[model samples]
Target chain A: MDNPNLGGEPGSLSPGITVLIPAYNEAESISDTVNSLLAQTVQPAAIIVVDDCSTDGTAEVARAAGATVVRPPKNTGSKAGAQNFALPLVETVWTMAIDADTTLAFDAVEKLMVALDEKEVAAASGFVVPRYVRTVWERGRYVEYLFAFSFLKPVQDFFGKPLIASGCFSAYRTDALRALGGWSNRTMTEDIDLTWRFYFAGWQVRFVPDAVSYPIEPHDFKFMRKQLRRWSHGFVQNVRLHWRRVLAVPTLRMIVAVAAWDAMVASLALVVLLPLMIVLFSAPILMVAYVADLPVVLAPILLGAIRRRETARALASIPGFLVLRAVNAFFLLEAIWSELIVGRPLRLYEKGH
Target chain B: MGIPVITAISVIFYILMALTILPILRAVQAIRRSPRGAGRPHVFPLPVLAFLMLIGIVGGAWVVATLAVYRLAEVVPNVRGLLPADGAEFVLLGIGAVSMVGTLILVLSAVEVLSWFCAEREPKHARGPDGQKVRPTDLIQGGVHSGRPHG
Candidate 1:
């Protein structure tokens, strides 16, 4: 590994923030990720890349691109563990974590810094759209992000609970993070686990809409399946782990309840009842229930797309979103069955994108 | 999330559809095709209008089925006795149930749309260290930054 010398521009390093990138065989993409951070308007005090025992030369690439590269003695197993390995070295006031494949807008860090201006905010996350939109899976995720970040997240932020500070790109106050013992690998998703812990600890997390990052999404079904499986298990695992603590937080409890309803009950209705009713009543028209909410769903999606000036893209992605929704329902049910009913859990962390 | 005004409008639209089923469908298509003022917002795009037409067609079919059931109940004394309420009451009751369910599912989005109108400001937290104040030399000595490449 190269020395921790400033590698991009000589004077790009600013004080108060250190960025951490956990890489595992990300040689192809780490340079762009590192350079994106180096190009930030409010530069990080240091950029540390935890190469996490990649067989590929991820360390060399990341180091060459201006990040101080460190390799764990062995694989950390999960992204959470890799991030935890480097967490102790973050000495700045703020510690940011970005995926090795993600790139930020020039002002992303600067805008996220605004959220931390509030003393109560323990962490902040930004809007995320997939870096590519060509694939069906990617287009589905793109629409999902636009709707979620533009609509759902803003409301959650307004209510002082933005569900989860997204893992792909987020910043945290160093002290607050250390106090919580860094990101937890107890669940499939370390970011949400940490965010919920912050809530339980009486801290706040903000969603800064202006701070945007783009990460490469899974372009094929195999990768999408892996990503979806992890995410599905992660949500169920977090709910089980934090149900008690969540109940103590009013808005958070409601949010979790609603999400559970959608994931479990509503999904069941869509998968089971729709088919059953159609067969029983011989009423094919009942199929409209599958898309009855289109009127309501389209309103927010169109509005969100209009804001991004991607109305055509959003419209074209609708079919992809529908297909993804069906796939998502199946995965959620599988997760519930496996985790809750079958008493088995998904403990392995595999990167799909 | 709080229930927003759109949810109410959506519920009302459904009820209006049930009340004047087929006629309302034509009226909707007519209004969608009608030209508006130059400065007005294009609330319904072509795709959205098409979706509404699909919903309208299906919803109209359901309403026709309900009317057929109402007529059956009128002729059959046993069927009329089996029903808890009159045909009109029963149809409204079904709509009410659907509306309630829709509201439950859509409250999150409703509040989100509502939030667009109400801009809530983030409260400023206590001031932390000023990044501009700290020099690169200061950061280097903090043990994290190594200024030179290693041999």
Candidate 2:
């Protein structure tokens, strides 16, 4: 789709949206993030990188990359805080919150904008794929995203509510986002929070699976642990906070509840129940029971990855996903135990690499 | 084991089962190779050595004694000569431990292989405008660098 009318000339592209990237010490990726947005097929009218008190020259790098730099007077510790800090400066009818570490497909914005024609659609997100898939953590995330976006997202979209308008690469109706106070910092996950609020405000969220965004997934175990912890805590926090209000929407409530239940069961099974069974029953052969799940998980990945390149990558990454599942289970159980049983709410917001 | 069911359904099921084994094989191979980032050798963390120590000690004992119990017994027909004169439960314990240790190693290998895969790949080359090669810092407008200096 040609956006010739949406050219870079000032006052040329009327009602054109702006890109807002929130960054903190992302000097390495800031330029690439901005450049990718600038190179989009449906080019945004403006790109603003909100620097959240970086020790590095993030602001200068962003400015050099053609993104107008906006820094809070003081450090906005969390990603949501930084995005909210720059929300007022957004003048366009539509605005996108692209993370500094993410790059999008050339036609991502073009595809995302397609769903917004329905006036009720408040937000649209593209599929998320990892930029770097070399590391175990990265490969695991690659498969995780592949399964979630390719399989789960389509089903969620059919029911008219995506689990989230993923934070990394999503466009929002400027007014609708502002109405919810521009990504609440009440939870560690602003994306989930904002998406639920949009539904609560009677706005629809769409997921365009074809529009892909590649963000750097965590590579190291330390980084992965931090990310998983934040994610687990954020999920529980949102569930605890939104459960009362979200129950009003039947489809969303059912989906969220089921997902939560499944996660709990699966986590317990992998990390606790299975091991306990093996020890108690002296069942060494039962250990292979995990092998049964291989096809169930890999089928969707292979189906999603029709291309030769993606198929090979998916095949290579399957083991990593198994590792990730155990890690996820461990973290989820820890989060639930800490938050629900121990009555210790996870209040810290640590950004994933 | 059961009836010889050679229908298309069984054939397809076997084919899928065979395909699933490919990933398990690849995972085994990945951990065997030393990981490299860019052109440099990547060292496995100290924890890998720690895991290997446990597996080696436990697996080594089981393999040695199990060999004595099974292999020697088959050849000599006198297991007590090789192993201690023990209860039948001891024999069961030896076999069970061997299988359990074998399975444990497989599980741990999958994790170690992933750790190798998860190590960060070094950036190939920093790029300048119009697709020209540039210094890493030059790619960033402010000349900010994160790692050991490179192209």
Top TM-score hit: 1
Question: How do the residues A1-353 of candidate 2 rate in per-residue lDDT, one tens digit apiece?
Answer: 11112213222334878888999999999999988888989989889889999989999999999989988899877888888877777777788999999998888898888877678889999999899999888999999888888667765765677889998999998877776677877887889988998998899998887688999989999899999998888888898888766766656875676567546765776788668866875644335444434544565578677632589889999889988988998999998898888999877887788
TM-score on alpha carbons, each prediction:
0.72, 0.69
lDDT of 1 by residue, A1-353 (tens): 11122122313323489899999999999999999998999989999999999988999999899999988899989998888888777767788999999999999999999879777888999999889999889989988888788767765765578899999999998777877778888889888899999998999998888899999999999999999999999999999988767766777876776787778876777777667866875545455456655544665577778978999999999888888888889899999999999999999998987
| Reference-based lDDT, residue B11, model 1 | 51
DockQ of 2: 0.01
Q: What are the Cα lDDT values of the candidates?
A: 0.74, 0.71
Docking class of 1: incorrect
Task: Give the per-residue Cα lDDT of candidate 2 at A299.
Answer: 54
Off by over 4 Å in 2: A1-14, B1-151
Off by over 4 Å in 1: A1-15, B1-11, B14-151
